[model samples]
Target: MKEESQTIRTKLAKIRFFSPEGFFVCAAIITVIFVAMEALGLRSSVAVLAGASPGAGAPATLGMACLYLLGYLAFVVLAPIFVMGSIFLLLVNLITGIFRRQQRHF
Candidate 1:
């Protein structure tokens, strides 16, 4: 059990997510979606959340509102996390590689 805990899990660490490339992709996708929704005037549709409608199909308005809200949340939350994670992972990998290379020469 002790040895198992001490052993590094290289497979999990090798996952492509949260890498510099992945983060940039994630942030770009999220920003695109948020901008698209904003450009479509979806923010006004979110008034459905307050039980107010533009006197049209209530279901459609509600759906658009929910989508906008979700996109907004993702933009506000996940985008920053991905950006920070990518930067941190890149720096850590760079520093570690430098250290390992020096140690190998020594």
Candidate 2:
């Protein structure tokens, strides 16, 4: 029984939400790219989010531009949100690992 409990505790410590972490990291990277495009004067491409440029008053030609910009902003925000969520999960996993390790030590 002791050996079996030890094995279980060690196994639990290695477990993690690896898939979600990978996805969030990827999304964050993509967001950074979109932000870069917006920075480099690619407004039209970034305006696809809100579908309109109500605040900027960029004119009809820039409508699409504004929409794309909004899109980029949305993605940028979402990426961080996802990354944060992943980080939270990581913390939870770490906590559980620690608990299991402590339990096994006895």
Candidate 3:
């Protein structure tokens, strides 16, 4: 029981959502979805946001278009920013730790 609990804790600790790798993976997945939506011509449907409602034939198209737009903004515009921010934070932490250790020795 003790060993299993320790393993679970380690696994949980390894799950870092704000890490650079995690951000990149999330960005890549969102990009793929955005590209797929664009390939299917959902871009035109998204223009409904400008000043038009989806027609009676497909009410769901409006919802899908909105979702695609949100995904595009999130993945394309925000993901890289998050990735860079995480990297910067990690580097700062590393440098600070090194400085602290050096100070401790001096």
For lDDT, the strongest prediction is 1
Best of the two (2, 3) by lDDT: 3
TM-score against truth, every candidate = 0.78, 0.51, 0.61
Q: Tens digit of lDDT per residue, candidate 3, span 45-97?
A: 77566657545236587787778888778877877787777688688879999
Model 2, stretches more than 4 Å misplaced?
A: 1-20, 44-70
Candidate 3, position 26, lDDT: 63
| Cα lDDT of model 2 by residue, 1-106, tens digit | 9999999877655544364556566566668777776676667443434545344454654665755656676686767777877778778879999999999999
User: For candidate 1, lDDT tens digit of each residue in 4-43?
Assistant: 6545444445556647867867887899999999998999
Off by over 4 Å in 3: 1-13, 50-57
RMSD of 1: 9.4
lDDT of the candidates, in the order given: 0.83, 0.66, 0.74
Model 2 poorest ten-residue lDDT run:
44-53
